[model samples]
Target chain A: MASKPECACGDTSAVAGGKKRIIFPCAGTANVGLISNAAAFQLADEGYGVATCIALLGSADTGLRRRIAEADEVVIIDGCPATCGAKIADLQGIAIDQHIVITALGIDKVYERNYTEEEVERVVSAAWEGKGRT
Target chain B: MKIEVLGTGCMKCKRLLKNVEVAVQELGIAAEIKKVDDITEIINRGVMLTPALAVDGEMKVSGRVADVKELKEILKG
Candidate 1:
């Protein structure tokens, strides 16, 4: 049997063919904040989007801000109502396509440092589902 | 010269401000320094990160704290 060719279509990690999507997660101290960060990482690992540092956005790194401004889609995941992630995007005048607050997903906020895989998945799904909405 | 430190009043922001002051004092430069805490103004100035420094309306450093040595170098330019 012949070996099948490796399909690398739509691989953002390798290529820059299409519009880029950027994800910013609020890596706060709270458990919910950590969950959002985990979810953003998972989404990026799954090739849903590229997870970027919220601090970089907040700091207004010119290169990073330019990338955010030029990105085709921008998603912000905040852990709580503080909405630091979203606020950074808003302050940068970047249009966010999706804004997910982990607490609003029925996840209680705790001042812990760990989060479960399932909790992370739930946030990821919510953020993913938010895509393609008019 | 006009210098502005932009941040949301975070610890790093305060530290950056202090560093800037120290740098200014050491350099003996008669520069006007301002602290920008308003989110709207910060955004309008295209600064996304707190602890950002702008010299004469041009962003010089951002997203991290610059030590006195680093601030001196940035201000010397």
Candidate 2:
């Protein structure tokens, strides 16, 4: 039997692409935070960019700092208007190319983590559509 | 008591040094404050972020510039 063709589609770890993009999601305990995290994961699975932790930047991780500096585009997703992810990026001197707030998308910020895939897709589409450009 | 300021000479680091001095003076504690300016040395001490405060060779905080009030709290406790 002939070997099947290799399918590397939607591989978030595929670094061979021309432009390198990294995403920082506000993975807080709230619903909006969960939404932001889920959206980033879906986007990463779709080969949009690699999803990374914002806490590393908060702690000033040297390796992650260098990666952020080298990335072509850095996306920051905040769960609410507080924009904790954006603030961390700023504190660590990391420039943000896109800043998305889930609350601004008409998504209510709730303490419970009850987010649907539709909401996650909405955020993913917002990222792809460049709606979060600051 | 040994209070070390770990940084690579950023503006915040300079501010942190001043804050540390004032904190020590205000508390009237016999503490030796040393500024660690080398990047490699700072990282070797397990501090990737500049403008960090280490008390008795223990990492307290990093990345953010803690205010004088916060410094006092950290130093005292």
Candidate 3:
């Protein structure tokens, strides 16, 4: 097994106010994952924090640790209640500013090809509005 | 054999599941493909990313969908 990434905590600088936004998507196996990806994309299209890979930011060999630690805010997107993104951030010792779970927002889990655009917008807007961010 | 298309039911998940079926048919493997939609259950297996593939309870891929060729190779191995 690949060892979990080593973590160094605390970003007092971003805490003081920075503009960098970090978004992470759990990208799980259902509509929730699609919803999260859609919302993240919409957020990016609307000029929110840049859309980058949560895995890239969570990398064990790169500067993901420092980037997340110093980010103005971190938006974690989990497809379902499993909250893979949120748990990963917590484990990595980085502070999570926001958390969005697709299934928690009323999207049912099913095997299908279509996604709900309205739901994606709502979730992304919620993340942008700082509903769960603390 | 139990084959799991690990995602929360996204397009990629559906696609991967379909591809898995195709690969299994081509390879003539009698595998039951299941969709793992529960985030908690998925993570309990130690996979934090989605759109993964697990065969017989062993995680093989995560965060992206594997094509038919790759799926065939994975199932063959």
Model 1, span A20-127: residue lDDT tens: 679889899899988988888887765557899999987889999788766777988889999898888788777787788888888999998877888997786665
Compose the digit string of candidate 3's lDDT tens values, residues B1-77.
99997767765466567778878998998989899887666667776555678999998867554556667888999
Task: List per-prediction Cα lDDT, in the order shown.
Answer: 0.74, 0.77, 0.68
Q: Which stretches of candidate 2 lie over 4 Å from their true place?
A: A1-8, A11-17, B1-77
- Residue A46, candidate 1: how far off, in angstroms? 0.3
Best by lDDT: 2
Give the per-residue lDDT of model 2 (tens digit) for B1-77: 99998877755466567778877888899999999886667767776445678999998967544545667888889
* Model 1 stretches with alpha carbons more than 4 Å out: A1-19, A131-134, B1-77
**Model 3 chain A: lowest-lDDT 10 consecutive positions:** A5-14
Q: How much is the lDDT of residue A21 in candidate 2?
A: 74
| Candidate 3: segments with Cα more than 4 A from true spot | A1-18, B1-77
Query: Which clashing pairs does model 1 show?
Result: A58-B48, A58-B49, A59-B49, A60-B49
User: How far off is residue B17 in model 2, in Å?
Assistant: 55
Number of clashing pairs per prediction, in order: 4, 0, 14
